[model samples]
Structures are given as structure tokens and as C-alpha cells.
Target: MRRRGLAFIIVALMLGMLLAALDQTIVSTALPTIVSDLGGLEELSWVVTGYLLASTVSTPLWGKLGDQFGRKYLFVTAIVIFLVGSALCGLSSSMGQLIAYRSLQGLGGGGLMVLAQAIVGDVVSARERGKYQGWFGGVFAVASVVGPLLGGLFVDHLSWHWVFYINLPLGAVALFVIVAGLPNDKSQTRHRIDFAGVVLLGGATSCLVLLTTWGGTTYPWSDPVILGLAGAAVVLLVAWAVAERRAREPVLPLELFRLRAFTMSSAVGFVVGFAMFGALTYLPLYLQAVHGVTPTLSGLHLLPMMAGMLTMSIISGQIISRTGKYRYLPITGTAFATVGLLMLSMLTEHSSLWTMSVDLLVLGMGLGMTMQVLVIIVQNAVDFKDLGVATSGVTFFRSIGGAFGVATLGSVFSSRLNDDLSRVLARTRLPPGFDPAQVQQDPTAIQRLPPELAADFLHVYADAIATVFKVAAPIMLVAFALTWLIPQQQLRETTKAADLGEGLGATSAERSSLAEVERGLVRLADADLRRGFYARLGSLAGLDGIAPQGVWIIARLDGKGWVEAAELACRADVSRATGRPYVDQLVERGLVERSDDEDRLRLTGEGRVAAGRLTRSSLESLRGLVADWGDSPQLKRLCERITPELLGARADRPR
Candidate 1:
């Protein structure tokens, strides 16, 4: 496939991922409005909990299915299911209906998140994948910021129903783009679906989620229903383990745990998920119920955290890709997160939004450093055969942690709030008909209460949420400790498939040549080196005042003769919005000119001269880098022939 085609596919996948990740947070700000309209006050947490439960349970199953069938069709199918669920959710008339529809949406969401990573592993080399995975993190950050605001906008201006309705058009565009751009490679090997394993695992997960959701909320901790669910979960999980060990193909192969990298990555992922979701879920409530902010303002308040996450994620990805070192990043990240969570635990009703935002930013930085790197680590550790399962396993565990965190922390918050509210109401007189439950259910009800009662309610909520963070702080410490156990595995420069193929044949001398090429490839793949090389090339081209991006646009015009701005942006892996500024800058510099054909750009004579210099400088740099290799034509020929083949083999594999 051409570079342009691959870039388009990646964009489409990002959009699909955005659709799924956005849904996770978009409903959060709207939850109060949803409860008010649907009248499921006590059952409010179920709105998020239900979707998480279904998505978590289905994650590994979707990965296994994608591994068996082709990923393209499976991805498209997931998008379609998500869209249907989204439309149904918008049409829901009752809270129960909404919960059910959200679960249906989750069933498809599992695939959207996992398969996107899996497909990238299939296409890109491991060395180059870090930068691309950074884009995935960027998508999550963007979604985290946008989803809440969009949800708030919908709830505030349009009806909250538009939150779900908005997904329809986006999903439609993603579906069309993916079907058209993503290549399908049908699995040639026969695959046996692990029916028994899926059933046992699904049952076990459902029971665990139910236990967490209902424990100490709907039922006492010692209630027979909760006890029975807990017992059944343990039994079902054991059975699933047994089934996996004996099955022809397991949904989650037990063998993966044997790798320290895989085990540690999964463990860290779980704890990070617990801390991340637990805080994000409740922070909005703090803003609305305690600070009396509107939903829109609550969304805006989260921007600091999102900004921290985005910055650190990109920076860490670039460093990892450049240095090929990773174990310490997660460790440092967890430490930051621990400190942030500790700070958050100290918050009182008097705490300001700025203080909260700073704490969240610290937590976000910590999470950003840890989350995507762990996935990359696990993917690097596993073979191509296990890539899909391994990638999905990380997501699956993280999501499970999220479901447990929300339920368990919610229980803590509710219990503490209820006790505090009871104490406050016991000492003070209330309006005759007002129920204390209304304060717990509706933020609007707090506003209607007398000043003293409302202040008491705010204090109780603030304290309860603080207690939740206090509980989570220790878990972050544990995650930090677990990072130490992650064995320092050397990050692979080539995809697993490429590595396997190269080892299959060739003389000892040829192997030596390939080793040299591998080293060169690693240096070539360094994100910093690539950026510097491009920057140097631009300067050498006599376009020193122009930005690197503008030079890239000029180069593309020189190579392709004439292309539209949209095509240039796609090929350059930038948004059209971002590309326009570079194009305008280049036009102003007289390096590029508007073509005779409408909307196309072409290089001028000055641009051609600059392009010639850039080409010569780039070739000279490459030659200098390889100068140490003995001037053997045979060895040179082998290196040149094998490198592209290795890349092509990896890219062509039907992962």
C-alpha cells in the first residue's frame, strides 16, 4: 500500500477510536440530567457501570474474533453495532432502556478500542509504532476534553439526547472511510472459537461486576445474593482458567502471563485504570454539587488535566521511540500519580477549582506516561500470533479495573455521604416533605434546600469524594511498586513477523549484514533523528525561514508535480486545518505557487532548486552514516535488498 493510503486508514481508525472513547466520558456530565429525566435516582451509577461491564467482558472476545476472521470486516461490524446502539440510546424513553442500550453500545465498543491497536501492530514496525500509538493517546486526550463539553452543550442547549445522536454522523463517516481504505486479509488458518472459555469468562466477569455494583449498595456485604455472586465468580474464573489451558485456541491464552513484561504491564494497566476512572468519574460531581458550576464549566475545568496528559503522552512516546528505553517512565509516572492523588485526598469543601485542576494535571501526567507505554511494551514482548490477544488483554484488564474502581469507590462515596448527611439532618430541622434521598440523587435538589442544609450537603459530598481519592492513593503506590518487576526487555526495531522472516534463511555473512542494517534502521526510526533530519533538510534547501512543515509541503509538490491541499495534508499525516497554515507560509515565501488546476499546488523554480539541495543533503547524510561499513558491494547489496523486504513482509502480514 502507498503511504498516502496508510495515512488515510490511520485517520479513519482514529476517528473510530474517538467515537468509542468519547462515549466513555460524554455521558458523565449528562448523568445528572439523565437521572432527573429518567427518575432512576438510586440506580444512577448503573448508567456508566453497565457500559463498562459489558465492554470489559467483551474486549478479549472481540480481539480473538478479529484474529480469527479478518480485522477489517470485524472493525466495520463493530462500528455498525456501535452506531445502532447509539441511535437506540438516543431514542430511549426510560433509564432502564438507556442502560440496556449503553450495554449494547459497549459490546461493540470493545472492538473499536482493541482492534485499532491490533491493526496498527499489523501494519507498522514496532520501532515506528510508538509515534503512531502516541496519536492514539492524543485521541483519548482529545476525546476526554471534547466529550464532556459536547455532552454539556447537548444537555444545556439541545436536549441530552443529541449526545447519542451526534455519534450517528461521525460513525457513518468512520464506517465509510474504513470500508473504503482499510485492507482486509482473510485468515487462511482454520480457527476454532473458544465457546466454553468465552462463556465461563463472560459469566465470571459479569458476576464480578454485579458483585461490585451491588455490594454495600443494593445489598449488605453479607447478603446471600452478594455472597453467592462472589462465590460463583471465583468458581467460574477457575473453570475459565482450566478451559483456556486445554482449549485449542483460547480467547486469552494463559501462556501470556508467563512473560514478566506481559504480566507487569497488565497489572500496571489495571491499577492505572482504577485510579484514572475513579477520579474522572467523581470530579464532575464535585464541580457541580459542591462548586455549583454548570456542566459546561465543569467540562472546561478538566482541560488542565487533559492538557497535561496530551503533553506528556507525546513527549514520552517520542523519547521511547528515540532511546528505546521504557521501564522507568511508568515508574516515574506512577510516582507523580501517587503524589497527585494524595493532594486530591486533602481537598475540602473550601478547595478551589484551580487547586483541583493542578492536582488533576499531576495525575493526568502520571497516567499519560504509564498507559500507552505499557501497551507498547506488551506488544513488543509478544509474537505476532499473540499480538491481538496481548493488546486486547491490556485493555481488558484496565477496563475491569475501571469497573471495579467505579463501583467500589462509589460505594465508599455513597456510604460516607449518607452517614454525614444523616448526621447533619439529625441535628437540624428540614422542610416537612423534603426527602434526604433527594439531595443524594439530584444536584438541583441541593440548590432548592436552605443555605445551611445545602452547605452541609456540599461539605459531605466533598469529604466523601476525598475519601475515595484517599483510598485510591495507596493503589497507585502498589502500581508504582509493580513497575519494578517489569523486566527490561529490549524494544524490537522490527515487527515480530519481520524478525522471524529474517532469521529463516541466509548465510552467516548475510546475517552480519542484516544486523548492521537493523542497527541503521533503529537509528533511522528515531523520532528525534527523523525530525532533525527533516529540519536540516529544510534549512539546506534554502528555505530556512520556512517551518519544517512548509518545507515538507514544498517537497511533496516537487515530487508529485501538482496536488490539492487535502491530498498534501493526508500524505503529510496532518490535519487539513494545520496544513493550510504551512501552505500559506510557503506561498508567501514564493517557494510554492498555485497550480493552473483549481485547488492544486506546485513548486516554483526556487522551490525546485531547494528540493535539489535537500535531496543531495539527505543522500549525503545517509552515505555518511553507513561509511563505517566496509566497501563490499555484496554486503551493501544485501542490506539494501533485505531492509525493504523486511518492512514489506511485516506490513503484508495478516495480523
Candidate 2:
């Protein structure tokens, strides 16, 4: 059956991914312009880096909240938060303010991306998920190309700040669509907070991001800062694992990672992020530095990569849907990306732009095929009960990878840029007062440098770009190896209740006595017991009362045209030592069945008929006895004179 909820999820997710992915590249083209105007080029990377750091940490929190409070609400909340942050970003007056605001944006952005995908898994069945995943991939891939273009357009034709400002209205619309129409369902909530798990998870993630951000940028790998962050990460991560084992509800379910597919997919995320970002981040620089292309043109040049990604994602989704095959998609994607990355590793200052586009296309195609496919598979294999946690865990890993890639690979790029610049500057005829390091970090300085020095600096930037890609290429190979860990077991498509294996498999209809009384076909006043209601009824006519309450228990025992006296007596424990004779009297009046069993006290066809009538009467009597006082005339009159009257107050009654 088609899932009723998929459409709601798909619409919400498309918007979320559009916004999240757009943020990743939208500012790329505008970065140079923003820095030039703001005069804080030394901290240019923070605008991106701070967001990445904050967003990565926040992704898991959103996932956990989605599982706790309902994804629909959390998703809407994220959009609101993001739009607010975007508006703030547009209003920022300095580089530091922009970085702080971007960090806020990342908090919402991370939640938007992770929660949307998790919501998709919750609403759709796994086997059917690839198609939607393909759609999500298409959204992401389109954003990759369109973001830079949009950023460039805003910078060239409009103010650079419009890049952030445009998000406000789009976000408002997305939020409205989600909050106004989506069903409010907190079905996944556990009713208790996972305090320990959230604490451990947050600590673990914050430390890990710190390790990634600080290791290459702030200090050496062995320095106190790096080592301390690493140590804290390990301790918190270990504590998180232990806590999850004992937690009534966990934010980070460590058990999920034990799945081979999950492990492989997580590794794939890291590798893909490492290679993908390292390459994409520098492409704009390469265009401006080496090819002398405008930012708008650089954004336009990236369309091939986005095209490749979108096409592969959609195609893989269709293929998987048709064949029920997902195992091969990731392997193929990783392999393709690896080859493409290796090819790009050979780039030089004069490498053909068309050739670079082809390589990027190959890389994007590889990426599109795998990223969503892995998530879809992992989602499918997990029990439906853990849908939120399972989906969120994978997303969390992907974010972690993206964060690490940007920071770690960025450091590689920066270090290489520095070393290459030193070499290029060594043979220079520059005066003693000008240091290449000082100029390279400052956008205004780079723009005003002597022509030869600028050319050499640009060359250094190009070489650093190539070096990052070369290092990232090996990471792609690692991603390919990780794909092997996923078990090839076919995705077990399921419907509700399929989780109960065949050991006790039975639907409600299959194990019932299809009879008149049971089906509500028998009536006490009908004077006709269908032959079926009587069949075998005498054999088990021992029903009697054993309840602590004097009231008898009754149910339509069979679809046989009538009820059984002896069966009602035994089931409800109407004992021979007790009111057996009164029951017999009712049977004698043709109100119940009486039989020869138990000294002619057992239920017969006649007795069974009477039993249903009397039990039904007694049940109604019990119901009426307790419904005594509401709207009763006696009760109403006694309280009325003393009660305050509505709009009938007397002057003497004023208190």
C-alpha cells in the first residue's frame, strides 16, 4: 500500500534540504566580496567554519528531539530558527558578528537537514524510500550549483547581504507549509528525557569538533589543545556508549553502528565529505585565481558536477526501486568518486577547465548515487520502532564527516598554500617590508599586490587546491573500502505487525468461531437459534462467574445462532453452590439454554439462548445504576436556591 504520510514528509524535506544545501555554497561566491567590504579577510573561513562547527553539533540534538517530540514540529521550529539567523546574518555589521550569526544559522541548518531525512524514514517504508531519497538528492545537487550562482547574482546585481536576506521569505513559506498543514503526531515520544545520553552525546560531539577544528588550525596534533580535545572526545564517547546501553531512551544509539551497513555507510559519509568539500571549496578559487573567471562564471561552471549528482541520484533511486537492489549503489558511487578524485589529483594551473568539469561531474555522479542510498538502506534494515534514532545516527555521522572534511582538508589547503607561497616568493624581487603570509591572509592586500606577486600567489592557491584534492582522493578510496562492510542481505520490506515473526503470526479474523452470536447475528428475542450457535456449545457449557465482583463476565462466544448457558456459567463462574437455580429458572423461561450435563444443569440449546438475554439485561442494569445523579430533578432543585444565578442578581443578595 502507498504510504499516506510520504507526501507531507517529501515536501518538508525538499524545503529543508534546499535551504541547508544552499547555505553550504550560497556564500561561496559572495565571500570575496563580503570580506573586501567588511575588512576582516583573515577570519573569512570562520563564517563558513563556525557554521559548520555549530551545525554539526546540533544535528544529533534535532534528531533526538524529532524522536521525542515529533519531527514535524521540530522541523518547523528549525526553519524558523534558520530564517531568523539568516535575517540576523544580513544585519550583521562586522566579520565577528557575521561569524556568530552564522553559528546560530548552523544550529538551525543542522537540525533542518537531519530531522527532514529522519522524518522521511519515519513516514515511508524502507523498500520504497529510495525514490524519495533520489528526490532529496536532486534538491541537494541543485542547491550545490544554484547556491553559488544565487550568491554571485546577489553580490553582482544586488548587495552581497541579499544572499542571506533572501532566505527569510523562503524560510517563512516553508515553515507555514509545514506547521499549518502537517499532522501533529508525537507518536515516537518516550515520555521521559534521556538526560545522560544527551549530555554525553553533546560533550562527545563538541570535543570531536574541537579536535577537528583545532588540530591543524590552532596547534600541532601533539599539542595540549589537540590532545586534550581528543582525550575529552574519547572519554565522552565511551561514556555515551555505556550510557546508551543502560538508557531507557538514547540519543545516540551505539548499537546501530554494529550493523555492517551502518558502519560502511558512516565511513562512506566521512570519505565523501572529505573529498567532496575539499574539491568544491577550492573550485571557485581556481576559477578566479587561475582561469580569471568571474564569481558568477565560477558558479556557472559547477553545474556539471551538480548535474551529475542529480542524475545519478534519481537514476539510482529508480533502479533500486525496480530491482530491490541497494548494495551496489554505494560501491559504484565510491568507486566512481575515487576514480574522479584520482583524476583531479593530477590538475595543474593550466589544466583544461572542461576537463576539470568532467572530473567534477564524475565525482558528483558518484556522490549522488551513494549518499542517500546508504541512508535509505540503513533506514530500511532497522526496526520501525527505532526509525528516528536510526535515521538520525546516520545523519549525525554525515555531519561529523562534513565538519571534519571542511576543517581538516581546509588546513591541508592552507598549509600547502603557505609552503607553496614561500617557495614562489623566495625567487621574487620583492622588498623586505612585504611578507607573503601577511598579504595572503588579507583580501585587500592580495588584490593590491604587484602583478607578478599576485600571479605567484594565485599559483600557490592553485597548487594548494590540488594538494587538498590529492589528499582527499585517498579518503575516497577508504570510503570505497568501507562500502564492503555493508551486508548484502536484501532489504526486508514490511507492513505493520510484520515484526512479529511467524511463530505466533495470526490476524484477528483467522482464529475466530464464525458464528451468529459472535458476529452479533444472534438475538435473545429472535426465538430462533441458528443451528451453528448450538453446535459444540453444549460440550463447553461450563461458563460461570469467578470474578471478585458479583457482576458476570459476558462476550459473544460464537457466531452460532445463540449463546450457551453452561458456557456462560463456567466462564462467568455461576456455580452450582451459588445462584445455579436462578440461572436455571431463566433457562426454563426460554431465556437461556439448559442441558443434561451437571444434573441437567448444563446449558442446552434453549438455555444458551436465555443466557445471552439475561446477561445483556444485567449489563444494562449495571450501567444505569451508576448513572444516577446527573441532571436529576431532586439534585438540581436542592442546589439551585443556594447557587449563584446568572444575570438574575437581587440587590439584597449582593455580598
Candidate 3:
């Protein structure tokens, strides 16, 4: 039953993932048709690139917001945005408008991937997560296969708008399952937000993306437009890195990178992304343009690639489950990918379809072996306190690398195609007024081209794609080499039982430490009335009315005729101790008077005055306290009637 629920959860998250994954592929199949209708070939790539740029920019914002509030609301909100974007996309009539709308879709798509993967990691243990992660490759396979099929169906019989329309229903289902079935996740709680660091990072990342998209395609590398952006990106990125080091709560945890293995692995993941995007983005184009197949047939040709993905993913998962060693998977996976890409470098317009399929299978096998494994490696190499940021940081860099690879590789392909087209045009005669700009900007121009010229132009496109692959293969080879640095540490096989003593029920040493803190004080008055003080004053109480000077002593000692016996006897007429004798009798009867020696045994003025005046320290000092206590002053006054009894009736009366 637990497994069943877990499986249901996995399926739900995959559905969210499919919304983004399918968009990437389905749109690719339908883009040519949309462009032909919209007639803006010059701006064709932006429809894809703009979405990526917007999505990448918003990724961290979603992650931070989720950390601040709850993940569930944001998850639901992300789906809503995606659905809205999809609706807007279907409504767009112009290429530029479509690109703008797709960016809105990218914003939500970005959140879905980051939070969906992060939320899964929260619930599942890394050891058991292998099977679920393998399910990602499964979704990737399904999306990869279905995207083109659905897009083809929509384009052939229905309107191409259905490609975008399809996302609304799927995304709605994903939103429902996530919002209704899943528990409200608190894994993203935070105390302080690094708003400053976020701003710096967003600015820096924006500059970098702009540089990547514009460099080598717009103006020159040294042009102010390119140089200024590139330089600003570098400066801001460095500044952001430094700022994060001092932050109490950093947007990106810099500490994980201090560990050499994780640092290298994250770098390797970024490089791995370069290879992943380079291949994934262009393979369909290769299958179509080079193989002379329609976009729909080309998507079917990718089945071997999907099979390769499933085969490697499941196999790697089972092996990791059995042996627990995981570090070597990425290292080996990148190696196979490099070798596969090397095989595909042999691709040509006339290359055999079977050969291309086999080559792609190898590439897919390599991807399956490696992609999800890097996330596990990153999580392992960091402290548990840093789990979310560290995990997101790794994904962040990978996304960055994909954007980098796509923009640069795409630009290169376009530039090279233009070069090839110009040369092909030069070789053949054309009308004197034929302008390249007009031809390049208009999709309708492709249909009007002379037969040989059309083939020439397409040949240039085929070579341009091959050129990117040639460049990309070497990059993959480098990534394969870097994977060697990935430590062969095993996936931790079990969720370690939680250490229950994280808070409050602390150890004895801690209790002792706390005790020392609370048990302290501030300085107080020096008057602590000592023993025998009252007894010392009793003798003086008896020596009264000797003289005016003598009276001073009487006044002084008049007070303490009333306290503890030891204090009363402190100066007791050496006689008072002998005769419980009415020391009371002497003082009250005035038979014996108090001393007159100045200051000889004087009490404080207030005490003397209180004793002599009240003949009762009893009524005034305690009057208010006792009145409230006993209901009335007279009743309170009566309560003290027991003093003689308290002093002892027999002792007080006769002796």
C-alpha cells in the first residue's frame, strides 16, 4: 500500500514534468509549420529561446518563494501560469507575439521542474529514490515520443494551435492531483531571505543570458553591445558570489562548493548539460532535414533513443540498488555518450537511417546513465542543512549550461548556414536584385525557390547542423573526461533513522550549561540583621530617663524592645536573661528605663519612632498588608492578639 501511494506520487510529479518536456518537443515539430504561416523566419528561434530565457530567469524566484511560504500554493500557481501561457500561445497570430507568450509559459515551466524534483527529494530517501528517478527517463521517453506524434496529428488534420492546446488539460490534471492528493509540504521553510543576493544574482544571470544569445550572432565579440553585456555579467557574477559568502541565509549556499568533490561534480554537471542540450535539441532536425523525413516520421525514429534511455536507466538503478556504488555511473555514462556522439559525427545527408538510430541509441543510453545521477551526487556531497539550496544550486548551474549550449550552438548553426547559403548562391546565377535579407526573413521564399536552389539552401542547413554536432562531440568528449573526477561513492542505501534528539531533550552537559546561566544575580543592600542583635538592645531598653543625654539612649533603644530574644538580649542587662522576668515588665512598666549614652544602642530613627509612637510596630507597617489579607484593619488588628500567647502566657505573666 505504501509503495502504491509512492507510485501514485511519482506519477503525479511526472505529469507535471511532462507539461514542460512535451512543450519542448511538440513545439519543435510544429514550429516550422507555425513559422510558414506567421512568416517571420528571422525571428524563428526566439519562440524557443525566449521561453528558455524567461524560465531560467524565474527559476530561483520560485524556489525562494517556496522556501518562504508553502510549496503547495506555488506548485498550484505554477500550473495555473503554465495553463494560461498555453492558452495565450494558442491565441498568438504573429511570431514575435508567440515568442513573448511562450516566455510566460517558461516561467511556470521553470518552477515545475525545480520544485517538482525538489519536492520528491523531500519525501523519498536517496536510496529508494533510484527507482523513481528512473521514472524521469521514462517520462522523458514518453514525452519525447508523444510530443512529435501529437504535434504531427494536430498539424496534419487539426490546427497547429492544438499543440499548445494540449497542455491546458494535462496541466490541469497535474495541478489537481498535486493540490488535492499530496500533503502540504513544509520542506521549504526559511527564516531570513537573501533579497539582496537574489537581486544581484538575477541581474548577473540576465546579463549572462543576453551575452550568450547575442554573442557571435549579433555584431561581433568586441562590439560594445556584446562586450558590455559579457563584462557586466562577469562583474555581477563575481559580486554576487562574494555577497553570498556573507549572507546569513544565502540564495545559493556557497559552502557546498567548498567540498572538492561536490564542487567538481557541480561543474561537471554544467558541462554535462552542455552535451545534453547540444544533442537533444538538434537530433530531431538531423532526423528530418538529413533523412528527408517529415517532422512526424522523424519523431518516430527516436524510439531507439527512448529504448536506450529506459535500458540504461533501469539497469543503472538495479545495479545501484544491489551494489550501492553510484559514483562510477556518471563517469561511465558520459564516456558512452562521448563515444556515441563520436559515432554520429559521421552523419551526412546520405547517411543510413539505421546508422543514425544506432548512434542516437548510444547517446540516449549515455544520458540515462548520467543525468539523474548527478543530482544524487550533489545531494550526497553537501550537509543536510544545505540540502535544498545545494540541490537547487546544482540544478541552477545545469540549467545555465543548457541555456549556454543551446544559444551558442544555435547561433553557430545559423551563422554557418548563412555562410553556406551565401557561397551556394554565389556559385549559381540569380536575378540581379535578389537580396539575401528578404529571402532569409520570409518563410514563403522557400516555396518559391528554383528546384536546385532549394536543394542548395537545404544542403547548407544540413551542413550547419552537422557543424554544430562536430563542435558538440568534442565538448561531450571533454565532459566524459571530467566525469572521471566524480567520486565513486555509493548511493546511501537506507534512510538513516532520524536522530530524535535535535531539540529540547538535551544532554546532561547542556542542562548544566543552561543552569549556570539562569542562576546568577545583581548586587543587593549590605544590611543583613545578624543573630543576637535584639538581645544586645534589651539592656539599653531598661536604662531609661537618666538625663536628657541619657534620654537620647532611651529613645535610641526604645525600638527593639520588640524582636527575637537573642537580639533583645544582645545588650540585655545581664539581668534580663536570668529573669524572663519581664524584661517586658521593665520596659512596659518603666520600672527600668533605657540608656541615654548618645548612639549607645540607638535604632534607626524610623524604627525608634515607629516603636515609641505606635506602641505598636504592629498597626502601621503591616496594617495595609494584613487589612487586605484578613478583610478589615480591626479584624487584622485583632489577629495579632495572639502575640502574648505567642510569647508565652505563663512566662510573660508571672516571671
Highest lDDT model number: 1
Q: Which residue runs of candidate 3 sit more than 4 Å off their true CA positions?
A: 1-14, 39-45, 114-141, 173-188, 431-451, 495-655
Task: Please write out the lDDT profile of model 1 over residues 1-655, one tens digit for every residue.
Answer: 6768888888888888888888887887787677667776556666777778777677656766777777888989999989999999999989899989998998788678767756775665544655666566557666866777778788888887988998899889888988887777744334687889878987998798778777887799999999999999999999999999999877779999999989998898888878877776788777777887887788788777766766677677777767878889999999999999999999888998999999999998998788767766776787645665676676667776777777777777777777888898888788788788777767656766788768888788889889989999998999999999887676755321121101100000011123323433433544423444456666776667877666555555655577786776666666778677777887787778886554788888888777667656654554444444335464345444333322212222111
lDDT of 2: 0.61
The TM-scores, one per candidate, come to 0.73, 0.66, 0.66
State the C-alpha lDDT per candidate.
0.72, 0.61, 0.59
| Candidate 3 TM-score, C-alpha based | 0.66
Q: How many residue pairs clash in all the candidates, one count each?
A: 0, 40, 19
Query: In lDDT terms, how accurate is model 1?
Result: 0.72
Q: Write the per-residue lDDT of candidate 3 for residues 1-655, one digit (tens) a residue.
A: 2556666677778888778767765776566567657866545556666666667667667766776787777888888988899999999989878988998998888777656755665555332333454455456556755766677677767787988898888788787777767777765456576777877887887687667666777767788998999889889989988999898878776777777667776676676666656565666656554454665666667667656765676676556656666778888888888888778777776678898889889987887787656655665555435655665566666666666666667777768777887897778777677766555554335446667656665566567777877887788777777777777653432211111110000000011111111110000000101222223223333333222222222332443453444444433333334534444343454433434531123344543542354223322322332322225433343334421111111111111
| Per-residue error (Å), model 1, residue 327 | 2.8
